[model samples]
Target: MKAAMIFDMDGTLFQTDRILEASLHDTFQLLRDEEKWEGDTPLETYRDIMGVPLTDVWKTLLPLHPTHVHERVNDVFQDKLIQNILGGMGALYPHTEDLLSYLAERGFPIFVASNGYPRYLETIVEYYALDRWIISSYSIEDIDSVDKGELIRKVKADHHLSHGIVIGDRRSDFKGAEANEFLSIGCAFDFSQENELREADVVVDDLIEIRDYLEKVK
Candidate 1:
C-alpha cells in the first residue's frame, strides 16, 4: 500500500520554544503599552499553551478578561509572531531538513498538517525553502476548525490519501492521527512529555528512528 507522511510544524519540525517565548514576551509588552492588560503573569507561564490555539491560550490566561479584548490580544500576538519569524528569529528542528529530504527522495508524499495559521505556515515554509520537499500542506484556517483531528481529516481528503502517518511532538497530534485512522509517530526529541508521546502508535527519539519506521512500513 502507498503511504504518505504528514507533519506538524511548531514543536515537530521546528523547536520554536525560545523564539516563541520571545514573541510572547514582546506581545505582552505590546499589550501593556496599549494599556490592554496589567497583570503579573510572565512569559514562562504562557509557554505551556504554545501549541494550542491562541484563543485557548487567552481563555486560560485571562478567563475573566473581556472576550473582545482577548480576541484583540490574540490578533496582536499573531501579528508580532509573524514579524518575529520574518525578521529571522526562529529555526527548524535539528535534522528536519534531512528527514524531509529522506522521505521525498524515497518517493513518499510529504506534507505539513499543522494547527498554525496558514499565513504563518507559509512564511515559515518559504523562509526555510521547505516547499521543495513538502508536496502539500494544510492549516487551521483551511478547516475553520481548531481541532487537530478534523484538520487531519481535511488534509487526507484534500490529498486523496487513503493511508498515511502523522509525525508530531504533542499528545493532540497523536490523538488526531489515531482519531483519523492514521499511524502516529511521536517525536520525543522535540518537547512532549512521556505520557503524551505514549499516545502515538510509535515514539521516536530521533530522525533516524523516523527513517527506520518509514522503511519498515514501506
Candidate 2:
C-alpha cells in the first residue's frame, strides 16, 4: 500500500460511549458492592480520558485501590464490554459500512488504530464485519507508550506509506497526525467536543463526508 487511511475505532467508527459506560458500571458493581463503591459507577469523569489505556483509566477511577484490584476491575471490565458487544448492545455510526465498502472497493488501504485492547478491537471488527475492509489493526496494548503518536507512526512506516491520513475523534489523534505531519481529519460528531479537535488539519461532522473530502484533496 502506498498510502493508508488509518481510523480510530471507538468514537470514530463504533458508537461506544453509551454501551461502554454501562459495561464500566457493571464491572464496578462486580468489584465492590453498590453501597461501598462510593464513586459513581459510570463516572462522567471518564469523559476526558476516553482515548487512554485501561490501566491508567483504572488508576484515575480509583487512586486508593491496589494494583491487583485495578487489574481485577480491568479484567472484569473487558469481559463485560466484550459480552455487551457480543450481545449486540453497541452499534456502528451511520454510513460506516457503506463508507468502508466504498473505500475498500476503490482500493484505499484502511487500518484501525486504537487505544483499545487487542481483543476488544478484534471483537468490534469481527462483530461489525469491518474485517472485510480493514487491512490490519493496532492497539496501545501492543505499544510501550500510551502516546498514540508512536503507534500512528509505526502504522505509517510499516506499510511503506509516504502519504496517509488519520481519522479520529480525540485530541491525541489530532496531535499524533499533526506531530507526524500526516493529514488529519477530526470527527466532530462523537466524543470530540469544543475545540478538542482544534489541532486537526480538517474536521468534519459526518463520517461519510470523509470520502468526499479526501477525494477532493487527493
Candidate 3:
C-alpha cells in the first residue's frame, strides 16, 4: 500500500516553546501598557493551550477580557512572533532535519498538516527550507472542513495514497488521525501533557524514532 506521513509544525517539527512564551509575554505586557489588558496573563496557562485554534485560544485564556481586546492582543502576539522569527528564535527539534532527509532519500512522501496559522506554517517551512523534503504544507486555511483529518483526506486524494499518518504533539492531532482512521504518532518531547499524548497509536520522544518505527512498519 502507498503511504505518506503528515506532520504538525509547532511542537512536532519545530521547538517553538521559548519563542512562543517570550512573544506571548511581550504581547500581554505591551497591551497592558496600552491599557487594553484587564490583568496579568499566566504564562504557562497560555503555553498549555498552545495547540488550540487561535480564536479559541484567546477566548479560553482571557475569557474575562473583551473579545476585541483578545483580537488586538493576538495581533500583537503574532507580530512579535514574526519579529522573533526574524531574530532567529525557533529551530527544528533534534534529528528533525536528518529524519526528513532520510525520508526524502528513500522517496517517501511527507507533508505538513498543522493547525498553526497559515502564515506561521508558511514562514517556518520557508525559513527552514523544509520544502526540499516536504511534498506540500497545509493548514486550517487550505481545507474546507477545518479539521486536520479532512486536510489529510484531501492530501491523500491529491497523491493517490492508500494510507497516511499524523505526527504531532497534541490531543487534537491524535483525534484527527483517529477520525480519519490513520496512525497517530504522538511526539512526547515537546509541550503536550501525558494524558493527551496517550491518545496516539504510538508515542515517541524523538523524531528519529518516528523514522525507525515507519521503517519497521514498511
Candidate 4:
C-alpha cells in the first residue's frame, strides 16, 4: 500500500492560537457570569498545554477545581470553541490545503490524528472543506487514546494503513512516530519550542518544505 500521511491538527495543520484564545475568553466570561469561575485565567496557559489530553488540560487550567467543575468548564469550553470555529475564528497554516491536495491527488492516504476532541476535529474538517482530501480523521476522545502514539496506531489499524509519516510540532509527535515505527516530520513553523523537533526524522521550517522530504520517500 502507499504510505499514508498522518497530521496533527492543532499546531500542525491548523493555527489554533486565535480560535482557542477567543473561545477560552468566551468560556471564562460565561462561567464567571454563571458564578462558576472566579479568577483570571490567561489564554497563554491553555496555549502551552494545547497538544496534551483534555484531562491534562483541565488539570492544569483548573488545578484547584474539583472534577465536576472540570467537566462543567470543559463543556462550556467545547461549546464556545465550536461556535468560534463555525464563526471562522481560525485558519489553517499557509499552503495547508494546497499540500493536502497535492498529496491526495497523487494517491496518498491522508488522515488527521489529533489529541483534540472529536467534535473539534470534525468541525474543522467540515468547515474548512478538508474532507475533500482527508480519507479519515480520528481524535483521542473518539478512540479513548492514551496519547498521540495510540491515536496513530488506531488510525493505522482501523484503516489498514501499513506505512506513513507522522507530522506535528511537538515531542509527542516524534515520540509517537518512533513508537509506531513511522517516519516523523516535525513542523517548526508553529508552536514548537527550540530543540523540540530535534528528534524528528525530518524537521521542516515551513509547511511547503514537507513536499521536498516527501519526494525522497515517494
Candidate scoring better on lDDT of 2 and 3: 2
In model 4, pairs of residues that clash are none
Best-first order by TM-score = 2, 4, 3, 1
**RMSD values, in order shown:** 1.8, 1.6, 1.7, 1.5
Error of 1 at 13 (Å): 0.6
lDDT pick, better of 1 and 2: 2
Off by over 4 Å in 2: 34-36
Clashing pairs in 3: none
The true-versus-predicted C-alpha distance at residue 206 of model 3, in Å, is 0.7
TM-score, candidate 2, is: 0.94
For each candidate, how many residue pairs have backbone atoms clashing (under 3 Å)?
0, 0, 0, 0
Candidate 1 vs candidate 4, lDDT winner: 4
Task: List runs of model 4 lying over 4 Å from the truth.
Answer: 34-36
- Give candidate 4's whole-model lDDT: 0.85
- Compose the digit string of candidate 3's lDDT tens values, residues 1-218: 44578898888999888588788889888877887676766778867876777777888877888888888887888788877876899888999999999988887789988777777888888888999999888887677665667777777778787777889998888988887778899999668889998889999989999878977977
TM-scores of the candidates in the order shown: 0.92, 0.94, 0.92, 0.94
- Ten-residue region with minimum lDDT total, candidate 1: 40-49
